[model samples]
Target: MDFWQWYVRRGRIDRRTWWLQYALPIGVLSVLALMADVALGNSSLESIATGETGYGPIVTLVGLLALPASVSSGATRLHDRGMSAWWLLIGLVPLFGQITLLVLTGFLRGDGGPNRYGPPPSAAPTAGPYLQPEPAPEPDRPPYWG
Candidate 1:
């Protein structure tokens, strides 16, 4: 599916893709937002570290924007392990549960073949009905010989 469709719960995603594609990007954005806030003097390092008055505006916006996608990514990763998205509720139990989920989705391998969540992730997102890459135009001539 296309990139946006990749955020849905219908697919499976292996650990590498989960980290590199989804998690890292969001994390990078959050860090950048924090940097901007600090540079702009909207928040200080101490405040950000303690979250005394909560996250700065930019970081808050970034988190809000990324929340749905993050949840879906975690759910799809759980699907890769042949578990329901409901398993993510384990994060509610506190630190241990969160760590368990992190290991399950961020370190363990997915099923070798198809399970309930369909085939293993194909590495890159494929085209979907709404968005797709256009075919490249054919060269008028093959090439010139050296």
Candidate 2:
């Protein structure tokens, strides 16, 4: 899938894909922020913790860009589990809510088939009707079996 569809689209996303989408950008951005901190002559975590502002703007900008995409992907992941997008608000409820959302989105399997959100993420797109083949004819059988 395209990056936009994978990260920004409001549709279903299975757990495996959700985990990757959720973790990758956060991990990459954290590493980049650490590198920027080091290049600026600050002790990475200590600088951030001490309220140093050197790398803050860079980190803030990257975080602003990533936040919406992260929320969108998370909402879609919730949809895959047959839950409403509103479930994302649970993260605002403090530590317990955040932990609950993590467990629900990261560990639970999605609904078994097509759901209100859409088909399973792994399903192939359907071709036009003209591309479909006719059903095979039935074979002749003995009268007793019939």
Candidate 3:
């Protein structure tokens, strides 16, 4: 599915997808557990590296926590726009670059209303933010009086 499609389906950015999508990265880190065997064999990278390095694990855990769904959805968005998922690094550009990238991704203009992705979102008339509110009705009078 396209980005907008994914976005609408998911409704909101979430953590479950992050874990699934980033399974590879987390698997790589799990290799760290092997350090114990290496240490026992006197062939470890660091014999005394203990007390939970803290940052690396914390960061990895957080990334894994958010990888599965979010990353997949983000990729869909890029594909919908004929852009590369790597372009998501635009988040690292600092200041306006990040904001611009966010705006583009957050809003799905769709592919000409119906591109290779699929049909527009049901083609229903969407309410715009600028729509004027309906005026309040006055106190009711008898129908016969009117």
For model 1, name the residue pairs that clash.
none
User: Residue 57 in model 2: shift from native, Å?
Assistant: 1.3
Cα lDDT, model 2, residue 41 = 65
- For residue 95, what is the lDDT in candidate 3? 89
Model 3 alpha-carbon miss at residue 117, Å: 3.7
Model 2 clash pairs?
A: none
Q: Write the per-residue lDDT of candidate 1 for residues 56-112, one digit (tens) a residue.
A: 789889899888888899999999989999998898878999899889889998888
Could you give candidate 2's per-residue lDDT for residues 1-146 as a string of tens digits?
A: 67777556766888877777665767698689777756766556675668774465566677777787778888988899889989999999999999999898888898889899988887855677888876555678433442
TM-score, prediction 1: 0.76
Provide the RMSD of all predictions against the true structure, rounded to 1 decimal: 7.0, 6.8, 11.8
TM-score (C-alpha, index-matched) for candidate 3: 0.36
Query: What local distance difference test score does each model get?
Result: 0.83, 0.78, 0.50
The per-residue C-alpha lDDT of model 2 at residue 71 equals: 85
Q: Predicted candidate 2: what Cα RMSD to the true structure? A: 6.8
Error of 2 at 49 (Å): 3.8
Of the candidates shown, which would achieve the greatest TM-score relative to the real structure? 1
- For each candidate in turn, the TM-score is 0.76, 0.72, 0.36
